[model samples]
Each structure stands twice: as structure tokens, then as C-alpha cells.
Target: ISPQTCTEGFAYDRRARQCIDVDECRTLPDACRGDMRCVNQNGGYLPEIPADPEPPSYPRVRTTAQCILGYTPAEDGTCNDIDECETNSHHCNPTQVCINTAGGYTCSCTEGYWLIGGQCQDIDECRYGYCQQLCANVPGSYSCSCNPGFILNTDSRTCQDVDECADEPCTHACFNTYGSFMCNCDEGFELAADGTSCIDLDECSFSEFLCQHRCVNTPGSFSCVCPLGYYVFEDGRSCEDINECDTGNNTCTTAQVCFNFQGGHTCLDPLQCHSPYIEVSDNQCMCSAENPACRDKPFTILYRHMDLSSGRSVPADIFQMQATTRYPGAFYIFQIKSGNEGREFYMRQTSNVSATLVLSRPIKGPREVVLDLEMVTVNNVINFRGSSIIRLTIFVSEHPF
Candidate 1:
């Protein structure tokens, strides 16, 4: 028996020992030419008929000659070009474009994209320096941006500085700089930690001598104050004593004279001398030798006045009396003879020539005290004795300070 022979479009299988129908569409490259559809039969292949009927001038006819993949046999017995794009027969990706040619078609990527590995991919355009400050890349395009404290200009590619001070970000003053701003305060105020608010400056706390008497803190400023009996000087920081006698602000009776002192004034009686004593100077008196009453009187009398605040501490030395002349072999003794009725004052002799009047007790005032202080000197070697008196007048004020 001879080997079995297979017909066209059929292949003999050695393993199965039978003839199988061949797939011309997969085996033959030019089996289905152009846009024509192909079908396989038991022993052969046939081309599918066109959807439209053949025209009268171009009638369908059977032919034995074969054509290439992109051409077909027409009724006139000649190969003709086919449009694969028009028939939707081209193999292209969804993102690719199908362009028809005379007999074939091509696939390409759309705008803003490129073809790679049989697929379409987006192109990055931000690699180029197109923005002045910043740039952002999108799928198909790029955008330009600016950094903080800057704005895009009309050109859309350049950046400009923004004026932050125009919005009044500071409480007192504002200054604009390149891409930034600064805040400042007024003359007497200071900038707060927030950089946008103002706070009062405590000028008084900066120095102890800002004011002579007292310092007062105000909003954004400071003021100097003086105590009661004093006035603020023109310099605005020192204190000056108020002259009540010159300003006529003193309260004195008609029988008294107003005398001004450092921080106060006093009302004093006019100096007078009686018969046994004669006035020699404004504050001194001498005894008359011709009068009999002068025999027991002091040799001289001196008038002195002092002003003090009320409630003075005890044992305070208020006044000092010194002899103007010294003599050889002369010793002196001092005493507060008359004003000791209340035991409020005493005398302490520091030396043979000087003595101090001391307050033995506290004295409350708007009151006055007159004390007769006597100093006696004796010289046993010369067999002589002499004495003098000081009529001391004390005026205590009503206030302690």
C-alpha cells in the first residue's frame, strides 16, 4: 500500500495517522489578501464575499491567480490597493493613530505623547527651565510658579517681589524690603514679641535717678513727681524747695514774722530788749552797767530759733552752742534751766567751749517750746566768774515728714 497523499489546505499527521485541515490564515502570510475575510474548509480555503453587491461594470468572477497581503484581484483581473484603516482592520493600540496609505496603514502616538514598546507614553516637558522661580510638569504640558513672598508677573515666566507692608501687618510702623517686611514702634513705645504689636516702655524702671522724688509710669511715657513742700524743677527730674514766705503762702499772725528755711517756714516774735538789757545787734543783747537790776542778770543774751518736725526721736541733738572767746584757766558748765519743766530737753557739754541741746523726749506739734540755756565760766586762778544765756525758741511742725 502507498503512503496517503493529502490535498491542498490539508496536512497528513504522522502521529494520528490521519489527514487534518490546515489553517491557511495562520500558516500562509498572503492567504487573506487586503481587506477580504478568509474562511477554511476541509481541503481548501475561500475568500468571503463583499457586503456590497458587484456593480454592473465590475462583475464578480472566479480567478486562479493569488495576490499579496495588501492587494486583491478585481473584476478586471488586476490586483488593486486596499484601505485597511477604512475597514478597521489595522492593528494599533487604543492611544495610537491609524493612518491609511495606498495599500497599508501606520500607527503613531498622539500629541504630547511618544510611542514606546508598542504603547503610548506621556512626555515630561518640565525638564527645561521655563519658569523663573518654580516649575511644575503635567502629563502633556508644564506650569510656572513663584516662591513665597513673590508674585507672577504679566509675562507668566518671571517673578516679582510682593509688598507685604501694604497690608499693614505692623501696629505702629511698617517697612517693606525685598521679599520681606519689618515692624517698628513709636518714640515711647516698644515692639512686642509678636513683631506686629506695640507695648508701653517702662522708662522709670530703667534708672533710680530718673526722678528726684518719685517716678510715675504712664502709657508709653513716664513722669517725675515731687513731695509735698517741693516742686518739680524745669528739668523735669529734680525737686526744688517751695519758698512759702516769698510766695506768701505762709500762715503767720500779725505779731509774728515769717522766716523761710530749706523745706519749711516759721513764725517768730520780733526781738525785744527790756530795761536791764540793751539790744546791741539783731541777735545779741548786752546788760546796762548803770542799772541796779543788771547786777544779777547774765552778761549777754543771744537769741536763736530752730524748726523741727513733730515726733522727733529721743536723744536727738538739735542745736550746738559754742563760745566765741576762750580764756586761760577758764572752765565752763552748761544747763537747760527753765524749759526742763516738762523734762523734754537737756544739755550735753562736748568740750569746755561747746555744748549741744538734746531732746530727751518725743514732742508732738504744732507747738512751740522756749528754753533758757545758760553757760557759766569760772577761773579760780583769776578769781573771776562770768555767765551768758541763750533764749532758744523751738517750732515743731504738724507733720512728721
Candidate 2:
């Protein structure tokens, strides 16, 4: 009767001139249970049941077969677990690993990465502040580093400084510092350009240092060397006078004396008597212009006691005299001022300028006679007289004792 009635569950109503479903369930109160829904059909109603509240038994109302998360419906109309890892149905990141659970899939971060908010993220292990010196953050780990001239210790988190001078790297002196070292030379040495070896300093070349005579350079020090006549002083930098005379290093003769000066020595010749006045044998004379003569003039004579025995006329002592300027026939007058002991001693002229003495005494044990003799030679032409004095000692003993 109306166009709206052609549709299902619609009926024509003449009072309102519209198509509508009959309210059969509402009018019939005992049509369906309380928990069941009522559905209007073509001139009838249908009952819709709800799920059951208890387990291990079918529901009070029938329901369609469905699958939960990570599961799919099988050919037998039963729920089956799905392998999301293999089927690629998981919603995990590409860098993460997907694993199948009982009814869901799980996501895990790979190596060198971590998981955050169901995604794979790079972990910064350096944020832990475990490194002692310098730290480098890798994906999921950390590394320790050190500065130049240093090395890392056994512990990965800490660093240690290196000592480059421990192995005797320097030729002279080795100095150690933080993370490095240096080579130094002594006072008399210079460091080489390579900074390891040392070179000897030329102390002789400098005018301010070293000895005044000579200078010698050694490995790490210098020495002051003196010349032949000088020696090194106590300070080791200056030269001192070497007393060659006192040290017995001189070659002065017996007649000379050695004198030491600043850098050398002198051999001085001592004084001696002149030619005419002969020097005393085996002795030197200190002669000068003022006093040029020797102190004593001595001559010796010998007489045998057997020859001078009693009643013997042979002469025992003979004396010879000469002058620097002498005439052939000049006569010399002689006088004995001493040795006038008795008639036992007799003196007589033997020649023009010579004399002899005879001892006529019988010596008992031993006897010595000292005589002071004087001679005067006169020149008759001008009446000029010259005199000489002499002192002599004679011994008269048996066997010439």
C-alpha cells in the first residue's frame, strides 16, 4: 500500500501515512529474556542472546569465532599463533629484532644499540662518567683515551702519563716531568741538536774561563792545565808559580843557586876569587870589589924525626919563596919573629931567595913547632923595600905521626 513497505521490517500505517515496524516485543512483555535483545522482523520478532559469564562451557548466546592479537583464523575455524618474526607482520623498527609471544610480538634492540619506547636507539655509555681522562662514546660502549706522550693504564677507564727518560735516553743527565722528559748536560757540556747527546764545551776557546796558561775540556767538565813552569792552583781555574828550586826540578850547577819566580826559575852564578889570588881548594869564596882577598895564606912543610936526630947535620925543613915580579940576583933578608924555642932549631939561607931549617932536638913523643916568618926584599938602586909575612906549622914526630 506504500513505497516504504516494500523494505524489510517496514509496514504501512494509514493513520500517519508512513512506513514503520510493529512494536511487538514492547507490547508482549514475555516475548524474550531480560538479557536478550529483541529484533523486529516481517510481521514477527527475533531474540538476540549475550555472551556467557562462566568459563569451561559454551556461552548462553552463540558468538562468531575470532582471533586475538598475534594470531589468525585457521582452516578449522580455530585461533592459531602467528610467527610475526618470519611473516614480517610485527610493527617493530628495522634495526630491532622481532620475537613472537603467546598472543603478541616483541621488539628488542640489536648489538651496539638500545631499546626505548618500543624502538631501537643508540646507547651512549660514556654518560656514565667511567673514564678517568678522556672518553669516546661508541654506539653502546665507551673507550678511554690519553693525551700526547701518555699511555692508557690496564684499567680501560683511566689514563697514565709516560716517562720518556726512564730508559737513559740522555747521554748526560735525564730529567723527568709530567707526560714528558728532557735531556740536560752538565756545566761544561752542551746539549746536541738531537737533544739526547751532549758535546764537550771548548773551554780553551773562551778568554774568561779556564787557566791563564792552558785549558783542557773533558766529557762533562773542564780542567785547567798549566805550562811547564806553572801548576794548576787549588781553585782549578788559575795557574800558580811552580818552585823548581824547592821541588828539585832545576838543573843548576854546584857553583850556581836556583831562584823561583812567577813562571820560571833562574840559576845564579856565585862569587869566586880572581885568578892571581887563587881560591882555596875545595871551597868557594864570596868576593866583592871592596874585599877581594882570601882570609888565610897557608903553606905546609914536612920533616922526618930520623933525619933530624941528635948529631945529624942533614937539613930537615926546606922553604921555597917566590914573588909575582922577581929579579934574578935579588937578595931577601929573613927574620923569625916566633919559633925561637932554643938552639934545637937552626935556620940558614940556601939560595938567593930560599931558606932551610935543621932540627937538632931529639923528639920524645911528638912535637909541633909554629913559626911566624917575615921576608923583606930591598932594591939597592932606589933603596925601596918590600916585605911579606908567612906563618907555618911543622910536625916532628916518629914515623911522621
Candidate 3:
């Protein structure tokens, strides 16, 4: 027998088990399916992934260190971080600061801060930069704070400024002394209005009665305010009335009707009395006529809804309702102001009604909001001598309600 084969191929021996090489390709021609192309290796097989597949997965496939995450041969193939900024997976948090170190990356807060941006970050313990007192570890960096009433020294990370004013242990202006200090209020100085510092004293009285005009006082100071019309003069003690007429701004309505009095200007009303000829008295032009009474044909105003056209519901500030005839009677303007509490006249429509007037009882006291719209008719022009014509005295008064 030969060492290669005993029989035609490898015949089954009774003592030694022997078999021939079977051709799997000739037996199972359709072994691999789809677009996969399989190839046999030493004790395993491999397949080419399909080009049409969106993503491919193979647990049996072998991979190298270069393609794996955090894989580095220099670090004994240990997992290490990739420089996300330089490499691929780099996603910093919003407003967070990202920094990559050897085999890893670190995150820290920006200047003037100690809180994280609320995202992923690695802590750097070896750094000298940290918050002042009590640095607490947060998501990214650390937070700094001072003790109770003590503020951060700012210059040094170890020292703190205790607000002696706030700390009840202090006595008076909290003067910071070395590691600690005490509160203090200076001499001749009471607690400040804000209770923070010492203040001085005012020698004036607090009853607001120092001068004839007015008196004003402040912390360690006092002043006097003169009356509205009076002004502080050269003496600084006595007050004087401000000559409004001297400034050409006197409150006189008519320039010819004003009379400068002792201390103020007087306002005169143009008056009209029932008379054939006018007579000037006090500011009124009184009449002294023989037959000036309207006992025969009187004057009046006519009032009626004539136009029949209603307008918008607005307050009637002023109206001109034409009477039936402009002669004979004249109405006495009695209550010409806001009446019925808040009730105002609304001229939605108007009228042309005739009305004749007669002498009625005179109204005594006036009321609120008296307007100055007055009118009176001239019945007949009579001249006592070569003077002016006769004029009727018309008086208006509001209701007292």
C-alpha cells in the first residue's frame, strides 16, 4: 500500500478510519444566497456585504484597532478618547467650553462663571483654576461661594470679607479689621437714614415754624419757603409780594378794567342795571330809567324739537336754538350748567318754538359749574340826555341741588 491512499481513493479500512475529500461546490452549488460572496479560510468563512443594503452588520467579521472607537495600539489597545474637534464625534453643549486632552477631553466653565452649560463634560482635577471658597463639582466645572455674611476676598482665594454690619456680633460702621472686624458708629454721628453709616444733627425744630413764609429742614440743615406771592428779599428774613404787573403778566382780563391796589390787582366785572341811561358804579354800569320795567311786553327764549333730525348721543356743550321771532320776549338764562347730578343736555334734535317772558321770582344762591354765557334783549333805545341807550340787567344763577 502507498502512503497517499490505500485503495482507489481512501477506502474505508477496518482498523484505520479513512475517507476521501468531498467537493462541496459540486454537491451544493447554491450555498450562499443574495449578493453575498463567501470565501473559506483556515477554520472560518467570510462574506462580502451587499452593496444594495442600507447598513451592514456582521458579528462574525473581524475588525482592526484603527477602525474602532478609543482604540490605540500605543496605549496597549486600551479605550481612549478621540480628539472630537480633530477627529469625528465632537458635540459640545450649548455655551459649554470643550477641550481635548491626552486620550480624553475636559470641560470647564468660561470666565466669570462656575456653572456648567448642562451637558456632557469631563472634569479636570489637576488644574489650578477653581472657584474661591467651597468649590462644588457641577456638570461641567465647579461653583464658588463665600461663607454666610462673608463675601469673597477676590484678591486671594482663601480670605473673605465679613459684613460686620449684617453680622449681629458687630457693634457699630462695620470696619473690616484683618481676618475679622467690628461695627461702629462715629462720634456726633447717629445711625444713617439707611441704617448703614453715622449721620450729623440738625439744630432747627421739626415743627415747620421758623419764618413768616415757610420752613424746611434736612439732615443737619434747614430752610424756609416763602409764600406763593411773597419772595425772600435782600434781608433774607422778611418776605415781599412779587409784583406780577411789573413783569407785564398780571392776571387782569381787560387792560382798561384793571386797577393796581395795595398788594394786588383787582378784577372788575362789567355790570348792567335796568336803566334808560347807564351809570358806572363799582365795576358795574347801572341804569337809572323811569320806565325800565318789562311789566308790559316781556322777552323770552323759545324751545321746541323742530328739526326732528336726531344726532349722535354726545353731550351738548353749546347750542344756538333760533327762536320763532328774535323780538319781543327774551328768556332769562336761569340754570346754565351741568344739572341732574351728572345729567347733561344732549342735542340729538333741535326746535324753533316761540316763547314770551314775564318777570318771575329772582333766584338767590348759585350752584356748581356756573358758565359765563349771558344775553339780554334791548326793547327800546331811550336816551335820558345825550348819553347811551337803555339797557336791561340780566342775572343768571344755577340750581343748588
Candidate 4:
């Protein structure tokens, strides 16, 4: 049998993994498994192993920020764009425009509101500003306030005419326009209610009851009146009365007493007695049979005197008017008081020289003493002759008050 040596000196290719034998005589070979050969490859030392080995790592893809170099994430994890306009914290004069980007801000000129020192500010519209009617400022925009009679409806952004008449722009009425209003009064007469509407005046009619007589109508106004029995007084419209009595208004009856005065006449009492005799009561009286005494001889005379206050007593002298010789029975004298309360009054007395007074039962009301003389004998009427001194005594009950 022949013995072969595994360790030998040679060069080998991986793709063409074939081993090219080394010249053993020129190269020095050390112990490689007891006399092995030594070989070299493109990558360096060669060792005998398997083909198509596993690699150490995989390929990686690059991101945008990462691809563009020098870019870094902020603390918020966002990338920022640098602003050149505000780079050094500087604004480019008053005329330059400023703009802001992702991470920075800028400033520029716009309309209305302005920018100062790179900061935005407001503009005063009330100054000689650009609002046609009125002005209002908001941030970077402007609004309008309509002139007096003209108004702007903010919701519609349109101009509405203000009614000057409605607003009473002038004293009474208003006429409104897009930007203003006017006032006026109409026709022959002035305004009726508002300063705008027209009204008429009646100058041809008697306006005031100017006719002093009956307000007669001629033109605008009028007059005075003179009544039948009156003449024009001091005042233009007043009249003075002319008395009808002076105008002969007296139409009196033949028996009527016509007493005439300044304005009229009156019929008075005739003062002539139509009925005769003396009064015995309120509406009655008696007529005497004879007026003259025939002759004065031994004839009897009886006169009774009565006291009005006391209903029970008579004057002492009248108690003995005549004797009981001819006229007998009794005569009753009644004293008259004022009321009809308790008793009827009468008195019985004898016509003797020593006559006694007798009072009757009491009575009331305006009383009268009845001089009742009667004949006890043959019914012969005693003749009362003439006047005599009759002493009358009055008796009265003391009032209880």
C-alpha cells in the first residue's frame, strides 16, 4: 500500500475551489495533520470548508432628513424650517414684507391694519381714512358706519336709506336718502300730525261763532245781535233789557189794582170790606139787633170781665152783674187758657151785692169766658143796658217747669 500526505503547500480558488498543488520542494510546510499541504486564496489563508456560507448582516434604507445631512429633530420630535427673514432677530426696514414658516415668523405690508417693528397693529379709521360713509376697524379689515340718514346693515353688508322724516331729522318730518334725510311741510296749511302730511284750512266758512247776533255765515268769521226787547249794550255782543211795563204791557181787569213799577205791574188787595159785623170767631161773627140805647132809667146793666191767664177766676166786680131775683139758676164764667189738655172751664156766680166767685172744671186751649145769664122765672129775657166798670180778676195755675 502507498501512504499519502494531506498537508501540502498550494494555492486554491473558492468559485473554482480546485486546489493547485504547491511545489513542495520550494515552500516550507509545517505539520498539518501529520504532513498536510499549505494553500492561499483571494481573501487570504485558505481552509477547506463547505460552499455558499451565510452572510453577517442585511441592507438598510435611508430617510429624507437623514439623507439630506445636517438635519436634526427638535425636542417635540418635529423638524423645523429656518427663516432667513428673521434670522438674526432683525426686520428689514419699514417697507419689507415679513412671513412666517413652519418654525419662524415674518412681517410684511397689507391693507388697513399695519405692522410696526415686525408686529401687527391696528389703524384708526376715524382719521382721514378710506370709508365712504362711516368707518370701523377690525384686525386687518375695515367696516363702514352709514352717514346720518343712511345706514349699513352689517348682516347683509348693504347700505339702507334712513327715513329722515321717520327719524324726525328736521323739526317735524324727515325725508331719508341713501346717506341723508330732509324735512318738509305740505300744501295750503301746515302739517296735521307729523311734519310730512298735508292739511287744509277753511277760510271761506265762519270758523268761530263770530256773528254777534246769530253767528251769521258770510266768509271766514262773523257778528252781533239785537233781540226784540233789548238794545245793544256796552259790550258788542250783549243787549240791555227794555222793560215791558214801560212798553205798555198793562192789561188789567176793571176791579184789579194795577200797581206799576220799573219792569212790571202787580194787583194788590182792594182793602174794602165785602162782609160786615164784628167777629165772634175765626170765620164767624154776630150782628147786633140794636145799636142805640132807647132810654136810661131803672133798667139793668150786666158786663162780664174775664181774665185771660187763669182759667178758674174772674174779676171781683163782674161777679155781681145782676140779681138772682129775675135771672136765676146760675151763670158760668170760664177762664180761657191755651191748650185742651185737662178740663173745660166755667164759673157760677150770683148777681147779688155780696156775690161769690165760683170756678168751673178746668179746660184747655185759647179759652173764652162765657157770660151765660139765664132767667129762672117766667122765661123773660133780661135787657142788658149800658157799659159799667167791671173789675176782672184772673186766676192761673203755676207752670210746672
Candidate 5:
């Protein structure tokens, strides 16, 4: 047989030496319709009538070209995009708009959003420096915020300091800083440890001595005091002697004259005792007039003769005198320097204010005697009486010698 080519429906027959139609449906009975049997014909095959599963229904005519809703028909019978954005048949997201393409429609994000993958997502609007302090990106929007110690301004994009010192929280002076505040005290006060309150400062306790001698602390000030034997000066800071004599504040007797000395005073008797008596002490007299009765007084008297006429020892009553003082338990120590007999002057304490001086020998003078007396306390503090001389006389008779 000669080789021959055939089309899809016919085969080359070597016996006939030509191409003829082959009934594929008759050769393969299951090939014509899935619901019916195959019938043979002259050069082709046909499908037998199939019994309807539903009476007079044709299975609702199955279609080969599938198309989505709101689509236009193409020339080859495929579905094409219907431009739903213009036709108003789209249900796209409100934030997005519909876009028509080759065989379907698409939803694209608007100005603030973008199309990502198959969905429309929000774009980050905060990337455009929308806030002055802080910016937050949200679902299609953005917000502004402030850092600590700041508040959002009226514009909703800028920030401002919160002014934390406005309430006057400091107890004394308040100073407003950049974002905070500080408290301070005045010159004489100090800030407390807690830094909120003020307290008074005691300068007396800190300074070595606020006063010259003695210091006293007041609420906000200090004072100075003078020690004993001194007086506070006009400046109230220094000490000075009082000069009791000049001030007439002394306790000396009127019979005595007051003399002022540094921090003290002295009193002096201005008159010697009248005659018929003789001066024996700075302030007293003894009766040297020849009267036995006067000599017999409880007190002692002293006499000094200008001449040594009689070798007879004069009466022991001839050399005693008294000096008075103001201090209790006063002691008198008489000091005399004449001849060796000057040592014989003795002083005695008879009372708080009274003392007696006696000599071991009567004064026989052609010589001068210096006498000193000191009035002192038990502790050796000198009080009053001082030193002076006494006088006497001698009767000279011729041969009566």
C-alpha cells in the first residue's frame, strides 16, 4: 500500500486508493454525548435522544465562556471589564476608588491610602512632618503628642511648657526654671532639709562670740553683756568702769569724802578730832586730857609725848584707837616703820566694822613714824580703812623736871 496522510475525521484506505470518512462515534460509542448513546450514519455519527431527568428541561444550557458580574461581552465571547467606576455598579471600599482592567475591576486607595497586594491599605501621613513635637500614625490618619512637662498647643500640632511653678508651691521665694522650679530663703533664714520650707538661723550658736563678754541670742538678733565690775557701753558691745564715786552710788559715810578710782572708790575723813582729846586714828580721837574718868571708858586711847620725861611706863591705856569698816568679819593689819619699836603696832578685829590699834610703847618723838592700816576680809579682799597719823603733847616745867 502507498503511504498516505489523513485529516482528523478521515483515514487513507490503501484498497480504495483514496481518503474516506470514518464514523468515530460508531467505532467508539461512548464518544458522542455524555448523556446519550451514539447512532451510525453515512459518513458520520449522531447522538440518540436522552430521557430527561426533569420533564421538558434541557439542564439549563451549560455555558463554556464564564464571566463575572458587571462585565461586557468580548468578540470571542469572553467577559470584559464593564468600567464599573463610571457605570456605578462597584462596591469598593469608601476609602478607595474602582479601577477597570482587562477582565475585572480593581479597588485603589485614595490620596491618603495605597493599594497593597489585593487590599487597599493606609499610607503613613505622619512621614510628612505633620506635628511639631510628636506624630503618631493611625489607620488613614495621624495625631500629635507632647513630651513630658509639655502640653499640646491650640494648633494641635505644636507643644508648649506646662508652667509647673504657677501654683506657688515654695514656702518662701519661688523661682521658675525651664521645666521646673526652685525654692529659696531670705538672708537671715535657711532652706529646710526638705527644700520646701524656710527656717530661722541662730547666728549666736554658729559664731564664736557675738558679744564682747557675754552673748545672748534672740529670735533674729543677738546681744552683748558686760561682766562684773564693768558696765555696758553706749554701743552695747563694750565694757567700761562705772566710777561709783562720780555717780554718787557709793555707800561711804557722809563724814567721809569719796574719791573715785578705777573700778572702785576710797573714803577719807576731813577733820581731826577736837582738843581735850587727841587724834589717834584716821577717824577717831582719844581723851588725852588728864581725866581718869575719860581714861576709864570701855574704848582705848593713844598718846604720843614730844619729850621723854618720865621713865615710868605710861599706862597701857595710852596707846589704843579704833577704826570702823562696813564689811563683816573685817580684819585690820597696822604697819608702822619707825625705830625697832614700830614693829610693836598691832591691829585687832573686834566686830564686822570695828578694829583697834595699840602700840607696845608710847610715842616718844623727835622722830617721824609712818603708819599703814589695811582692812580686809577673810579671803584677803580689802574693803575700807586706811593709814594716817595721831598726835600728842608734852608739858614742860622748869626744875619741875
Candidate 6:
């Protein structure tokens, strides 16, 4: 090798006897072009290329300096803010807001929202007690609501109670309270299970003693009823026997007497003498001594009248007959002598001097019955037998009670 020729980026070292590489980046300040870095290789120096190989072109105009982004140069040689909001040139999303600063503008989330992880998120206004009853959150906004029985007020944040009674929800009456309502029924009526309807109150079924005789249930009240010879008292709960004789409500003729009892009335003939009998007193008749028919007839006949209810139960003691005068060593026997064709009545001898008239069978009627009850007295010491007859007329009512 005559002179040891080296490459352009290499230098020859005499002592070492070899070409050496040079660090061009450290030795030459302008080793590479603008915006490019320099590197030394084993045989040559290499210039590092940039990502953008070409530089930006600018206008051929004379100016002191260029303004930064989001600003512009003013006529007075000062930087001015580029109002991105007014010019609609901001980088903020459509739902965000843009605010201007000294030399630039900033992007921020709108009202009722906050920036979270570079995205606009709705703020939970309800957590701050923004509404009195209810709240709902939407994108960048919020709303207030009310419960079922309340209404939103004009303030939009407060709640007011709704008057449900204004719609007439109750059948009878309605009462309004805070956030609720109630229903009430009228007199003689009751509230149903549904709480908004009314039903008739069964006053008669509630108490059997509401009426003395019978209870009649009406729409909303009860009435007392009495049988045919009685009337309801002024108190509307008791019954009083009607005196048909005094009230002239009986069907007695001119020759009959009207007799009143507890539930009915009867007509009876005045004391009169039959063919072989003579009237001795107002209620008694005796046999004539000269008449042969009187020999077989009873020694004395007494007239009586009574009233009873229809469908009278059997074995019911209706009347009692006791001998007024007592004779020593004398005993009496009782029998239903006549007018008992159906055998509805019988005589029960309780003692030697007394007898009871019992209903042996049930009798139903708006009718009348005549019974001839006889009592015979036997005196063995006097060796005499005498008999008395009671002509009793019974009037049965049409009702059982």
C-alpha cells in the first residue's frame, strides 16, 4: 500500500496502522442537514433521516415571529385568543362546552355533567337532594318527579299532595289526607271490603230483639211488625195489644159481644136462655124445673170467650177452670163434652176441683172454634150428682207470632 488510502468517514492512524472511524455527530456541529441526525459507520458517515422528510412551506412575507396554536397575531404586535367557541372550531364534543382563556380556549363538559376519563358523564343531582320526591338522570341533564299520590310543584324541585277525593273515588264519602285518602259510608250503610264502595247494613240480622214481634229489614233500616190484633209501639221496638172492642175493629154483630185478647178478638153471644134453660146472671144459665129437656141438660151453663194464635203448639195449656165453691166430701171430674169434633183440644184434670184446657193438636186458622167443657161434681155423702158446662169460643189468628 503506497499511501494507505481511507474512506470518506474513516481516518488513518499512523501508529496503529489502520483507518479509524470518526464520531461525526460529536465533532461537526453541522454534520447533517436541518432537523436530521448524523452517524459514523465503519467505512462512511451516514445521515439519519427524519419521519417527515420535507419541511413545511410558508408564505414569502416579512414578519417578526409566528404565533402559537389557539392564538393569532394582532395588528399591535400582540397575541390574541382565537375564540374557538364562537367560530365553532373547538375540539370539544357536541355535548361539551368551550370556554375562552387568555391566549387559548378550553373544553369542558356541559352543565349537569362532568368529565370522567375523557368522556362526559351525567351528574347524579339526586344525590344532592335536588328533588323533594324523585329524580331521574339523563345525558348531561336531570329531571324531578313525584310519587303516585303527589304532584310536582311549579318550582320543579318540590312535591305537593294530590287531592284524590276530587275525583269522587268513594261511593258515599271521601276524606283526604297527606298523600292518602279514606272512604266513609252513610248512616244505616256500611263500607265494603274494597274501601271505596258502600253496602246496606243488615240491622235486623245484627240483633233479633230489634222488634218485639217481627223484624222487617228494609234498604237501610229495620221495621217492627205486629200480628193482627196488635200494633207497634211508639218506640219502634215493642208491641202493644190492640183492644178491638174499644177500637171497634171487631166484626161482632148487634147480638154478639166483641172480646179482645193478647193477639186477636172473638165474638160471643150474650147470656141467653135456651129452650129448657133460664138466664140467671150475666154469664150463667140454669135449667127450668118444669121442662123435661132440662133433666138431661147440665145443671148450669157458663159462657166464655178467648183468643189464641194460629198454629198453636200441641200440649199447650190454654185455660184453667177452678171451682169457686168447695163442698166437703165432694170430687169433680172434667171432660170435653162437645164441639171437639176434630179433637184439637182436651181437658187435663189437675186436681179434684180444677181442670186445664190443653191444645191436644196444632190448629191453624183465620177462623173460630167452639168448645163445650164440662165438669161434674159427685157428693157421695149427699147422694147427688151435678154438672156445669162452659161454652167457650176461641178465635185463632192468621199469624203464628
> In order, what is each prediction's RMSD in angstroms?
12.5, 24.8, 29.3, 30.6, 22.7, 14.2
Q: Residue 181 lDDT in model 4?
A: 53
Q: How many collisions per candidate?
A: 0, 0, 11, 38, 0, 0
- For candidate 2, the lDDT comes to 0.62
Tens-digit per-residue lDDT, 98-204, candidate 1: 98877688998877688999888887766667678898877766778898889999988889999999999999899998877899999889999898899999999
Q: lDDT of candidate 5 vs native?
A: 0.57
CA lDDT of 178 in candidate 6?
92
Clashing pairs in 2: none
Worst 10 residues of 4 by lDDT: 61-70
Alpha-carbon error at 66 in model 6, in Å? 8.0
TM-score of each: 0.55, 0.43, 0.22, 0.25, 0.35, 0.70
Off by over 4 Å in 3: 1-200, 203-208, 218-220, 235-237, 251-256, 259-266, 269-277, 281-401
Predicted structure 5, TM vs. truth: 0.35
Give candidate 1 misplaced runs (Cα > 4 Å): 1-138, 142-148, 205-208, 248-255, 272-301, 305-321, 332-376, 383-401
Each model's lDDT comes to: 0.79, 0.62, 0.41, 0.41, 0.57, 0.80
Off by over 4 Å in 6: 1-72, 84-95, 124-130, 166-171, 191-219, 225-228, 248-256, 262-264, 288-292, 312-315, 341-343
Model 6, residue 346: displacement in angstroms? 3.7
In model 6, residue pairs whose N, Cα or C atoms come closer than 3 Å (at least 3 residues apart or on different chains), thus clashing, are none
Query: Which regions in candidate 2 have their CA more than 4 angstroms from the true location?
Result: 1-67, 72-80, 111-144, 153-157, 163-166, 172-178, 184-187, 203-209, 271-401
Instruction: State candidate 6's TM-score.
Output: 0.70
